[model samples]
Target chain A: MKISLNKKILDKNEECAMQNSEFFADNDILCLNVISSPGSGKTTILSQTIRDLTGEIKIAVIEGDIRTDIDAKKIRAAGASAVQIETKGSCHLSAQQVTGALMAIPAAGMDVIFIENVGNLVCPSDFVLGEDLRVVVLSVPEGDDKPIKYPGTFAKADVILINKIDLIDYIDFSLERVIADIRVVNDKAEILQLSATTGEGMENWYNWLRSKITQ
Target chain B: MHETMVAQSIFESIQQLTNEHNARAVEATISCGQFNPINDEVLNFAFDLIAKGTPCEGMKLNIKHIPLSASCKQCGVRFDYDVYKPGCPDCNSMEFDFKEDAPLLLEEIELEPN
Candidate 1:
């Protein structure tokens, strides 16, 4: 007799997500799921955050991409243990992928673990990787309407970093619009505007990450 | 799943719904909430195509768009869709209990068997 495979697929994913969450809790590790649209500085922020917090605390990074280990390379270059989760065809990273990456990284001894999600604004918000915090990035080049346009991702974020602030003068991103739109979805999200390239406003993000680990 | 994969799933949703119910389905309804990243326009097209060869061919498919609604575990205020920003609208607290469950639910099946 053939068993129903579709239902099993969903059940497996849920089980994996719960197990991943349990792993994070048992180890007293703080996992951060960082999501953003393509090229919204998810990796760059990971790079910067890793660099700033590296020596002060032992941090590791898990990079999720449909293909390539480029982001993982960047995170590794910034002096941290990095692992890559290649989803291949899956648009978003599941709890299993994240947990698999967690196995690669030494999260038990690390201060913070940043799981950079696949660069899609839509699907990753659905699966939870048992992260202590969820950071969503929106770059200046991505424009202001992203908050409301991809509201689900934004609404799920613990911190909204408006990256690429160095190019604010050159772009059409409206802080007012992003703020207003974010307010409609998440009334009290901490909005931090910074440029990972220039490191102009990187302190707030680092501070936030530190605060989460401390708590 | 890629964009095409999701598109295919939408089509599958329409086909599976009809197959589970009947060959000629009338007034079929589906619900896609704000949380699910589904392209209804494409889903509609997929539904039309799927319905063409099946019993529910040419049957009008209706979709009910569900909004995101969550309640705060601490404050008990239900919030919806905007997951990126759900600090309580009333308390200005960042911790909100989000009610974004399964977005694509086949709520009710309508079939007219001949």
Candidate 2:
């Protein structure tokens, strides 16, 4: 009997991602997977979010990076519990790693768990990690052509954060073009334009976030 | 630097196969999907490090390029991928269910005598 080994090898990741989601649901914790290119202001957005919602919503973070405890430290300094998971060299964070990190934090006390994935636009989208929402960050500097260039990331995202709007005037990005392209792939995703540096569209982002957790 | 993971994983698989086969060196032939900014030079450098002096000492590496393919889920139209011209040619709808870059992967290795 010839068995299909190759198919399972390629698909094990997605299966594990689903299992991780079930684990989070059982614990009654809403997880979020944040995906972005390097320096797209993920750490900055997270730092700001942690500051804005710290004690009000007992948060815990499991930071995934190829290397660095910097994000976890920032979240820690923001006055929330944090853990850093170094992928050693993997481009994306696997569900096994996320589930392992979840065990370290007390599930009962935590209202939300944010999995700040490795700074990658493509691979992270393919992996789930049991997130209640998959948020993708695309800064103005990354250009308006990104959604078209990297469709998989845009398609996988539930919310698209067009961050660093303060630099919009300086950059040659067309907000309309970006939205138009994103709408082509994603019809239901909410696009919020904001700057973590300036706190422009953060209110809407916070509301979108809160609504998900409450629901 | 940030490109096809299928290629990256192929490089990893070759280094492992060389060791498991107890080959003195590996002769890898891989079909690289599309012509993106994947630095073959950098991949070779990485592969060298990953396969150094283990079972595979000196190997000839080869990479073949393939183009991107996409099929729109809306009108069910399929075509070769165009980065700048993303919308479906027939429908003119940017809502094409375009597939990301992926090579039709086939790995072949030369083994030394056990």
Candidate 3:
């Protein structure tokens, strides 16, 4: 006989994500899950944002890496509490892992928490860690066709940041094409162009982030 | 890939369901939407690998592909389209609101009394 279950296969993870979401909501923490490819400057962006908004906003980071805590150390250096989750070989961060990381950090009185997901455009998009916003970073070096190529990730982005804009003149990246492509995949994603290293156009990002915190 | 994790979850769900029903699963059906970037072959292979030595071994895994449906912003026409090439069928407008339901689902399972 055939039994109709009709359950979500990822329900275990989804349930955990819901719990995390409730935790954030109860604490009034604005959680952001950041996803990107290997060299898309996710760490640099978070570090810069932490440094820029150090006093005004209390930001903590849960850094996900395959094996190391290098990014977490950088986040600590930038003056925010950081908890590193080494996934070992997993390509994505699960909600259960985030729960452990959340317990490790002193989450009291924090205005915002950023979950820096594993550097994988595909896997990280599939797993939700109870974040209020999903940020997908596409560097100028990653090409303009990334939105269409990785529609699963781009389509779900709350905000898309085109990092490495300072190298736009030297690289063959098309800013207009990228924006148009992002529109095709996700019409509602707020697109921002900035250089994390050079600090150009970062004020817009900071403003947007601040506005989100207030709301 | 992420499919490995998904497959492991599927295995655990099947194990739990079978245990509750006091039977063994012989076949299973899953539904995946266009928005979900799951490769069926990879998912099947991973499932088989994980199911080995378990009661779910040799179970037939059937996957159903669900296309995403969207409503046009300009013409107000609803249609199904690929996520990669998203556009309205009637108005050809790129602007649309996707009406996709749950992307991945374990729909049913065929069981045998053990």
Best by lDDT: 3
**TM-score of chain A for the candidates in order shown:** 0.92, 0.93, 0.98
- Local accuracy of candidate 1 as per-residue lDDT tens digits, A1-215: 11111221133455787887788788777888889999988888888777777678788888889999998898889889999988897888877787777778777887778888898988788767778788898899988888777887887788999999999999877899889778666766799999999999898888887788888
Q: How well is candidate 3 docked (DockQ)?
A: 0.74
Clashes of each: 19, 1, 0
Error of 3 at A44 (Å): 1.0
Candidate whose DockQ is highest:
3
Superposed on all Cα atoms, model 1 deviates from the true structure by an RMSD in Å of 6.6
- Native-to-model Cα distance after best TM-score fit, residue B41 in candidate 2, in Å: 14
Task: Give the Cα error of residue B80 in candidate 3, in Å.
Answer: 1.9
**DockQ (model 1, Cα):** 0.12
Q: Rank the candidates by lDDT, best first.
A: 3, 2, 1
The ten-residue window of minimal lDDT in model 1 chain B covers: B1-10
Candidate 3 lDDT, tens digit per residue, B83-114?
76667877788787777544788999998988
List residue ranges in candidate 1 displaced over 4 A: A1-11, B1-32, B40-64, B67-114
TM-score, candidate number 2: 0.71
Cand. 3 TM to true fold: 0.95
Alpha-carbon shift of residue A34 in model 1 (angstroms):
0.7
Model 3 lDDT at residue B22: 84
Best by TM-score: 3
- lDDT accuracy of residue A194 in candidate 1: 94
